[model samples]
Target: MKSFLVGIVLGLFAFKCISSLYVKVLKPQSTKTGPERALLVAPGAYIKGEAYEPLGLQIRETCDFQLWVVLLLDFFDNIVNPLQLGEAVNKAIQSLKDEGFTDGSPVFLAGHSLGGTMVAMHGKNHYKDLSGVLLYAAYLTKGNKLSDYPVPVLTLSGDLDGLTRITRIMDTFQELYEDVSSNMKAKYRTPVLVMEGVNHGQFASGKMPSNVAEHDLPPDVTNVTAYQKIARYTCSFISNIASSSALSQQVLDEGFNTTFRLLEPLARVKALETNGFSHWTELAQKYIIELQNKTQISVRGIEENGQMIKFEFLFPKAEVHNSAVAITTYSLVTYPLDPFDVTLNPLSPIQIQAKMLSQERAKHVLPNGRYGAGNITCKDINQLSILEAFQNSSDVARERFSKRGRQIYLDEDQIVESSVQWQATQLRLSDGSDGLHVSSIKYKLPFDPIQESKSGLFYCALLSPFRAMEWIYVDSMRLKS
Candidate 1:
């Protein structure tokens, strides 16, 4: 009898594993059957920055407008090749309209890193009818407004992200939307979401971990566990917004009514620690009760472009503030292109004899500890010089690279000397092992080497050595501007 019970348990485990794998492979197959009610604009993985092949092809097969995922790497591929970003956006937008998905049906735009930023942009400019927006380590372009929001937006990021440092970006988004539309700004609305323990790359389930090189551990952090709970709640909020036309009113009423009606659940917070529930859901249901008790909080107008956009939150301050404990804020702004600069010349790809070279002129002990080349340029300086701006500050450089790297100059040994050429520019890399070899990096704003400044959604694309060259093609080659 014991052996039989053991066999039954093992069989069940096997069934679960097989079922999980089957669902994973067939998940994308959702597009095969008919006109989808929802559309997904997915960001490209590390390889294909803007490869819309899956979505394009999926539309041809399954007419179901159920979901759309747009790959961002290609949509914003200005880092490696600054030509394809605009084209990707245009094509994706056109694809949505062309599919005959006009009104009522919800559209979802989601991307990781650069892809996520594009989703934000798309939702801001187009997709007025979208149900929700989800971003992972994404950046927001300045001047774009997301206020008077027709749909809810969920921006997720790991607290410990070293590369993207998206915390600042989230703050900027919250501030920017405060006054863009008086009607859209939330008086008591919380826009920023902080996911504890999640690294920048863990937005999806089962994908390879971005930090796998250093740590062979499972993905779990106290904060991330908290974040996971929040994610479910946020997704549900967004899904509901997309599902209903009177979403704004309904969400507000439901949220407000629940605040007072569910006080008993909030009172059991301490008991939760002793009783040890089966899942976090039990805890979350209690938290929802806490939200239902607050009658309302009034939020005044928000400042935007030096002007105020008025709106009010009816929930009480204590309830709203408590709700925002996991979230934080930042600031963002935009400046227009200078029209007086008539000498603006578009950067044409140059044929570069790719030889890695670092700054040999180290006359004194540098603060950043390493002597690196000024921005590597093919020929003329243009907007593609953003890589230089994101370099570790001299202080950070000295600790991590200068002293540790042990070489006299920074990035001196890591340079690869080879003949590398863009369409019109020739790239001069640092020729040594210490020199950083960038696989892929995408930013929203055009780099201005001449001005010596960088801005917008900056992303680094990391891939295995085998997939390096494929990165070029997967990142679309079209230029929109």
Candidate 2:
């Protein structure tokens, strides 16, 4: 009788453990009502759904977004039956919809550790109605690469994700990135963020000491800072995807900046591979955390709409403590270049530009978690302001400019205005706290030319006084007469 009783107690414990993990769906406990957006999260293997509670709560406190986590009991879980998994996800989604979350609301899926893999598999297998996928501390198999994901995908992981190494992250991201078309690349550059001192388990809630999947390495970042960074990046990426705004092609240019130097790492896939990821992660743990800086800025993109050329610049902020440098001036400059098929230059390499887009000179200096925008227009007869001329260090680039300048009696050293009409305005989607201001400024150019001759390059040139001179290649002004 004693032995039978012991067996019953053991069985009860086993059932409780299974109950904690068996794909149970949980809504964040804060709100009785639904939110503007709904997020479904998956926790790592052997970890309960509660492991992701803190992330959900942190996200909930800032934005009106609902967070849910599901735990599936499997050993080293893989998305072998994605169709079945998709159905399970749909169940939770339907529950949200029933709670008045509705069909109009945007639904996002995030996964941590194995859960991260689940998110990718969902995207790969059935990306039907999803807005976007956020993979936290997750790596994708070649079979799971999101080459066909129609929406914006963020493959963010930590440098210290002991189980899901950054090397795998980079290798898989490059694989997926290169497979997409140029148009997709132009639209969504597939932003990747690797926070310093962060590891796999933190994306979920607690220490997760026994979850051996997350290598038992010491994370140097504090909980407040870590969650703040995760929530911040997640929000920004979602905002970008939802608005369908281009984050500037700065990553490909010489001046793209991220905390990890991914601006260049995106192209140099083999650099980290030379040494194992542990070496890289150990170094990244030493990086400092801050609140505000214009980490990314460039010409958003150039598009032709009827009689005008729409030119927009993307101004994105980074996490920091305070802002020291206030207003940075950027001159919107352009010069002619040859079309892709034929190699020819316009007669004059006249770098035409409108007046500089300067910040309002605020006390806080473009504060943390905010963007500034303003606009103005220039007519041909009103006389457009010459901010600065374009300069190329390459001998081949300089030779092309010099030859073209001589053909049209243009000065290589001066900013010359051609007969181009310009108009600028802005439409901002504002969201912030701490009484910070959000600014919107969009610059536009009418399809007016001295005459339509050849293709050109548009630039958001950081014309001096604040920092070193840098050219942000906005877009190739591929004109169609």
- Tell me the tens digit of each residue's lDDT in model 1 across 1-481: 9999999998886554333220001122443443334434454234343343333334323322244433433222222112333344445445556655444555555555555665666666565545566665554444444454445565545433333432244344445344434644341232444443344434433343333212211224543353444344344444444543254445443433332222112222212112222111222112222222222211221112211111011111111243221111111111224343111111111111111111111111112223233433221111122222113122322233323331211111122222111111212222233332332221122323353211211111111111111111111111111
| Candidate 1 residue spans exceeding 4 A from truth | 1-41, 44-104, 128-132, 148-152, 166-170, 173-190, 204-219, 222-234, 244-481
TM-score of each: 0.33, 0.44
Q: Which ten contiguous residues of candidate 2 have the minimum total lDDT?
A: 466-475
Put down candidate 2 lDDT per residue, 355-432, tens digits, no spaces: 222222221233333442322112211111111122312232234333331111111122223313222322111212
- The candidate maximizing TM-score is 2
Error of 1 at 4 (Å): 78
Can you give the lDDT of residue 66 in candidate 2? 50
lDDT, model 1, position 261: 29
**Candidate 2, after superposition: displacement of residue 78 in Å?**
12
lDDT of 2: 0.42
Misplaced by over 4 Å in model 2 are 1-35, 64-84, 143-145, 173-189, 207-214, 245-256, 259-481
